[model samples]
Target: MSATTYALGAFILLAYTLEAITGFGSIVIALSLGALLLPIDQLLPVLVPLNICMTGFLVSRHWRLIDRRLLLGMILPGMAIGTLAGYLLLPYLDEVSLKRGFGVLILWFAGRELWRLQRKAPAREHTPNWVMRLATTAAGICHGLFASGGPLLVFALATTTLDKARLRATLVSVWFSLNSLLTLAFLLDGRLVPALPQVLLYAPLLLVGVWLGERLHRRIDERHFRIAIYALLLITGTLLLVGP
Candidate 1:
């Protein structure tokens, strides 16, 4: 195998491992880190299957813990509308510029998260339905464009609850639902068939990562891990914006 292929597998392993631990980070982390090895277009279509399989495993494992009300009432419609809108807009967009813009946006998001943590801001007792809807919409747009919308979705969910298991389960449920649609779209577009073999090659690594991640989940300090992730995302986003 080529070095790029090897690098891609490593990123997949890391991304899926993080997903297993946190519930919804595979795509975001992969897109951020894989930018160096491949363009966004090549990376996304190939990663779709991995995303679906890993997220499906998570959803099945945590089916009972998902917050169904939040899934149906807030996440579904907003993501549907936003994703559709983004898909419609894709043909007109300049891919390179859009990617660079997204990189900058990601950096800002990571910075804001770090600042929020630094300030030790009090968690809001209640997040309005409209706000949650809006956040989900933004997440859907990110998914439509880059297939990396977990952070926005997580922002919306973080406001709704603090229970880790519920958060992970609910987020997995959302990713599984969205990723299934994306998988179908890829299949319809003829993207999946060509990439299936590559995806299969990485499947074992994805599974192993998930297994290892589940083991680490109990031992790691979530808060510290999250902070470290955000910091890493900031650096990765900056690299994306700067280019090689």
Candidate 2:
């Protein structure tokens, strides 16, 4: 393989490890690093398959932890509709709009977390119906647009009853399912399959990355873990919005 491919493969494998272990979604890790070496067009297709495979692995490994109710209540309806809309409209949205939207989403999420930490927001409450309704819908809208909407949903999930590890698992699992569905839809529309050769070629690196991410997750505290994620989101959002 070429040096670029090898490097990206290693990068993806490391990202996967973090997602696999901590239950954090891999979209940002994949999107940010993959951007350095691969086109966003190519990266999206590659990540769909990786997410599906990783989800399958996690479902088997942590099936017991999966939150079926939340999956159905918040994710399934909101995400499915949003993805369908994205699939239909993604081709038309200008890059400029996408970047601006991404910036808004990132700043909103990051700023909220920082505010929460400073205010020492009291013991978190269950996701109210209205909050879930709004957050899930917004998350769906963003995910459909960019395939990088984890921070929105992550904010919602982080404030809930589940502990850090379980929260991660649930979010990642939902992401896996959503990506799998989106991939099949993309295949039907013929937007991505022609590139499957690269996907097949890079499979090993994907798996290795998941392994590493999982290991790294175990070593860090959850609060710190989340801060790192928010920091990355901030950087990604700004670059996408303001970069030439």
Candidate 3:
């Protein structure tokens, strides 16, 4: 393999491990960093399926913790509609524009999250239902467009009543379902076949990431880990926005 391939594998391992711990952020982190090495179009097909594999495992293990009512009643419907709409529109979008726009979005999210963390603001008791609905729907559109919608969904869910375990379980379930849809879309559009080899090549790395992350999830301080993650994201967003 070339150096770029090795670098991408490292990024994949790091990203998925984080997701295993947090139940979200694999694609956003992986895609953002990987896009610096490879094109977004190529990376999404591979990253989405890998996400399915990881999240599928998580969902199966934590199915009992999922808030089914919230998922079905509010999150799923909005995301489903938005995802399909974004998928349909993907072919018309310009790749460079997409990358830069995604960078800006990530930057804003990371900066806001870091700011919140720095101030140690208490999470809100309730996010208005309409706001959550809008965020999830928007998250779906982002997933369809970039396969990196966890930030929005996470932001929306942070204010909810679910505790850490339940929230992580629910989020992974969301990724498993949405990414499956995205995988099918890729199959129908003739993109999956071409990406299969790369997907297969990285399977072991994904498993290792999950194993390590699950262990870390049990030991790490949540606040500090989050601070580190957003810090990395802040730098990544800067690179994506300015790098050639």
List ranges where model 3 is wrong by over 4 Å. Answer: none
**Can you write out model 2's per-residue Cα lDDT over 55-91, one digit (the tens) per residue?**
7777777777777888887766877776677666778
TM-score of each: 0.94, 0.84, 0.98
- Tens digit per residue, CA lDDT, model 1, 1-244: 9998998888889888989998887888888888866877777778877888888887888789888887898898899788777666766777577668668767877887788787888875677888888889998998888787887887787767548888888887877888788778878887888888888899899779878888888799877887888898899888888885
Candidate 3: tens digits of C-alpha lDDT, residues 164-224: 7898899899999999999999999999999999999998998899899989989999889
Task: Indicate the residue-level lDDT of 90 in model 3.
Answer: 90
Relative to the true structure, candidate 3 reaches a TM of 0.98
Give the clash count for model 2: 13
How high is the CA lDDT of each candidate model? 0.82, 0.71, 0.91
**Best candidate per TM-score, number?**
3
